[model samples]
Target: MIHAATVQACLAFALLACVSVAYGKPTGQASGRNPSKAALDADQQFDKGSGIAIHKLDGAQIENLLTLGKVWGFLKYYDPTVTSGQRQWDYELFRVLPAILEAPDRASANAVLVRWIDGLGPVPRCSPCAQLDRHDLQLHPDLGWIADTRLLGKTLSRKLQRIHGQRRVGTQFYVALAPGVGYPVFKHEPSYDDIHFPDAGFQLLALFRYWNIIEYWYPDRDVIGEDWDKVLAAFIPRLALARDSATYQLQMMALIAEIHDTHANLRSSLDVRPPVGHCHLPVRLRFVQHQAVVTGIDGTPPNTSMLEVGDVIAKLDGRPPPALAREWAPYYAGSNEAVRLRDIATYMTRGPCDEVPLTVRRGDHELRLKVSRVPLPKDYLAMGDYLAIAFHDLPGPAFRLLSPEVAYLKLSAAKASKATEYIKQAAATKGLIIDARNYPSEFMVFALGSLLVDRPTLFARFTVGDLSNPGAFRWAPPLMLEPKAPHYHGRVVILVDEVTQSRAEYTAMAFRAVPGALVVGSTTAGADGSASRVTLPGGLFTIISGVGVFYPDRRPTQRVGIVPDVVVEPTMAAIRDGRDPVLEEALRLILGPTLPISSIEGMYRSQSP
Candidate 1:
């Protein structure tokens, strides 16, 4: 016969015994010290005593944790019930990593994950949350651990339901609880090079880290032209097979290229093969009217007379221009076909030898020529001598009046502080030509844009991710530039080409928004966004477009550059004759009859001598 008092006393003793074992102290002394501090100290002691190294893991173990980590990061952001409006959620991956790495099999690894989730208290519920739509959801159905009800417990399923519900009903995939709070966003600055890959464990860590960052935060996933989930599935085996440092670096480059972004490229320390570090053919090629034409040749004595201006390159070693471009497309990072071909033309000339065989078409004659490849000059000018001849005679001032009714501002040399002064000077002019053929010296989007408008105009918008809500993107408020007093209501002409990228493209967009502003010249590089640098295993560094930029109506500007109102590409004759065709067109639109054809011809002829 058991008595109630005896049973109660026995239960109390058992509870005290459990507390002593867990806390490493007796019941009386456990209350004297801070409970949290004691618990932390005990955890550290246990970790130190354990034979397992938390930072290291085998190939199998790495793959498992990578799978679990992806799911863990996703739920932390997308599941509103899990976050409960908290600005920051504790990831604590290192705390449980040892146990996870030590697990012998998939079942055992899952057990470790279950224990980690249980430690995080009950998940709150939101009754009004909507269900998830198919298009908005991505699930790893192959991973049974994620779907196992017993492992997740009842609370996790309910929390997942709330996340799905919100996505379905409100079309909200993720929401930023606060600005700059959420996932660890990688910075795009170059801080380190030669990241030595010490071991396989460290290499795998880099792979997992990079994969998760792109999976959750990449804003242009939909425009990437491939199923991102499938890419993750395919790269698993490939990354795991990287056996050496060089191979690992190459693998990282291959993976970065999967994003299809021009900004994605290994840092300069790791030489990108096939596209760099080779002797050039000493000729500049441009895609003109869908044909590859030699626009200029190197004036070096060894390369002189081998190739001439206006020669059409029909074949390289035996392959057509288009086929050759396709062969090099994987190695040449670019956002669009135009930009890709532009870069490929430069790379096609590179080789180990100082000469390459080519089939060229010169008027009616088709002849085989061996073009000498010379080392690029140290003070190489991108514009070459022919184009430089046209600008040589222009006034040395960065901003000057082409005529009384027309003003020209060279964006590459113009100062931002002088933007207002330039605008004031050009206010009465009939036309303003803003030359952006080269990279801008400084950002002048707002400074120059404000002077061209009469009222506040929305020029651009951006898409940013919610840290707590992975894969959820929402448009930030439109960026508007208010007009400064004495706004120039004159026609604006902006010039652009391959060199006009990033800030230059952004500047063009800003100026293009001005009433009657016309963008001239050829297509731009089409890559425009804030670059974010990502460091991978083995000291490999690369970059990606961190944010999505779009027009006011949500038209994408990533792979597609800002279109020009009047397309005026320079011809081979124009380059040889030292004439500025694009500039001539801009003047035609502005000065019309005031500048006669004979006057323009004489102006170009005078620069010849």
Candidate 2:
């Protein structure tokens, strides 16, 4: 039987913050740690070992997948010699990998990777395993530095590539890495199966995760504080509870948070997607000073009040993090930021019961307001982009209002919700206008291909992972030629602005493969192909990479964005009012075959993603 006292005591010591919700935080006080003497000594030992001057793990092949610099950092922290008993698997670099990393017959060496990771049954057919097989493997540019264990990790990954079938929830699947060959043994259950690095051991994973960037952060941390460890290990009782699935998702997102890089991290999947649907508020809010400040309202009762930004949060009703995590504490506590900051995220993203009551504090008075809840419009559900596709908030058309016959739809974020029904509404229209102003996810363009493809034609395709090393291969999804519904049999014009980047460029490139699609506007934000998200220790999170998109032809549309078929720019004067010269030209092209009465060199023809 689980004792409540023991559970509470262990909760204090375990430092596992399990307070989790479906989605996420703020920059308040980061959860700080003061190292005990032992932890300090361990840190010293790690530092002392660094002087040993082990060669840098440099290799083009594995760098793309493992990022050698990062892998070495993590390994040094875990320091394989350290051991964790509870862990199901461990890693040994030399015995497991020396031959492969040093091998000149690279293909033979690469083949070992497949053997290392492909273990057990009900595996190899899984999505991860299959995707691995399809990827272009880049051999290590610096083959000499490849660690046996890290190579083993590559091998383990190869093994994992074989698994088939899928679990119902979560994309960051779990795999168990056995210590001996450093192979992957488990496939299906990523959550229950804990992943560990034998060298770094499991004593302090946060350091490997948190300190890698060496940005504006340096904190003293201890895995086992004297008072806490003694109290928990001797006096506390053992506690085991079934993990909540939602909390685990929250935890996974937290892992993404640890890697602040925009391009590299975990993905649910590019093919299968998540629900873009979200519970929204009647009012628009901004995070001013750690408070959910109201900005605009769709004319709701509680939101009608003139609450401006810069107001401090006085109090929140049950919707606050404190209130939400009262039932599930660890997720809130385990988060990377101060606990208070998490409360703020909850206040923003989470739906409120009945009315969401808030107390915004100005100088002397505390204003109380209650806002009625509403669902966010589907098109507007994007993370950081303005929602479009006939959205009501904006003034008339972003492009030419009547680019006579041409209908343009440009967006940044593609969320899974009915608010997004606007796209269907767009694809069904006659003339086409696609504003690749600032693209978001690759899945949006590829996933939405069904909506655009009237016939089976190629979209865009590009190589994923590294394809240099002898062993490494490419991960290329099909260039979607199938349409979601019927082809919108109309003249299609796509507009791209300077901000057209990553997924935006990919979307533009996708249509370029089509016969009649024309790209206009200025250069795009270059960086394609990044289905990335970071994973934090505990439950912190972030994302990585600059782009997550690639053309079907396996060409790069990065640093240098996609070029427009028709080179038309927008002017400042035209932008001041409601004028899109490029869009106007597109409309002209659709309605009439002639070039515009306007000049060829214009500014942004339309404002879109």
lDDT of 1 by residue, 1-609 (tens): 223233223322322221122222322122222123222334333221222233334666755565555655555455553434322122244556567667886667766766666666544454555432334232212223344555454544444444444532222222222222111234221122343443344444455556666775677767777766556655655565566666666666666667777655554322444544446677778766666778766665655746777887898767777777776576555677766677566556656556667899877889898777777554222322112211212335578776678888877678867888998999889999998776565667766777788987777766666442455556665676677766887899988776566666777887888887888887776767555545543434555566677887788887778888888776756655546787787788877847786666554344332
User: What tens-digit string does per-residue lDDT give for candidate 2 at 1-609?
Assistant: 223233223322211111111112111112122122232224332321111111223343232222322333332222221111111221222222444444444455555444433321233122332122333432212223334445445553333222212211112112222221111121211121132212122112222332332210111111111232122222111100113323334333333333322222223211111222244344444332334444334554654444553344456553543343344332222112222132233324335335667776654678887755555554332222211111211133333333333454555444423223544455445567666664342234444444556666655543322211111223334455455554456767877755454445566777776668788776554434432222332233333331223455545453346878787754433432435566666666666656544532222333332
Over the full model, what C-alpha lDDT does candidate 2 score relative to the true structure?
Answer: 0.36
TM-score of model 2 relative to the true fold? 0.40
Which 10 successive residues of model 2 have the least lDDT summed? Answer: 215-224
Give the Cα lDDT of each candidate: 0.58, 0.36
Candidate 1 yields a Cα-based lDDT of: 0.58
